[model samples]
Target: MSVSGHLATITSAEENAFIFDSVANGNNAWFGLSDAETEGTFTWVTGELLDYTNWFTGEPNNDAILGEDFGEFKADGFWNDLPSAAKASYLVEYSTSVPTPPGIMLLMIALTCLILQRKRIIFKTE
Candidate 1:
């Protein structure tokens, strides 16, 4: 997975294991075959196709012109089910889990340096 132009490619079994755990427990359904039970039509979070026919009766009937249109993906070109255009959230799961970004490591390194530097200051003050 990537964030703010940084990429973290998941290329290991341990990482995939974590992704599976996250998706299994996460509230948002971002990965794996839909429990509705079908194969080969595996819908991706990044994909535009939503199975409207499988929607619950009266579902996916969202109005197109009302500006609250989230179900118009079946007929209208409007963005559906995704958050607003300005949002930068990531879908962290699929059939397998994705990777956390490298920036988190950088942040940890910076925090560690700051903490160690504080220790140096205390030593000098004492």
Candidate 2:
């Protein structure tokens, strides 16, 4: 499934696990990019080579307990490829412009205002 241009790849099999990060970096709405690979080479639509690999232990083994043949992938908080007999879904994110939304903008502004208010109050009392 394609969500906002971020494609979510999943198996129709009920045992397959979904590969995506809906809450990426603590944000609920985020885009996850999953690329298909063969022979240790990835072919992502983004055109950037994915070299970030820190999968959970015992993961990406491609165990055929449910089924197999789809392939495998993993990121810090996401993983893919499971039993073809199991069902799965993909939740993806995409950006309309070249730059993505600054998720921390509001937080930064809030902190700045908080600091300023504190300083003003302290100086007033002094």
Q: Model 2 clash pairs?
A: 13-85, 13-86, 13-87, 14-85, 14-86, 14-87, 15-86, 31-93
Give the Å error, residue 16, model 2: 20
How far off is residue 124 in model 2, in Å?
Answer: 46
- lDDT per residue for candidate 1 within 88-124, as digits (tens), equals 2233432444676699889989999999999999999
Specify the highest-lDDT model's number: 2
Estimated TM-score for each candidate = 0.23, 0.36
The candidate 1 region of ten consecutive residues with least summed lDDT is 70-79
lDDT scores of the candidates, listed in order: 0.37, 0.44
Clashing pairs for predicted structure model 1, backbone only: 19-97
The TM-score leader among the candidates is: 2
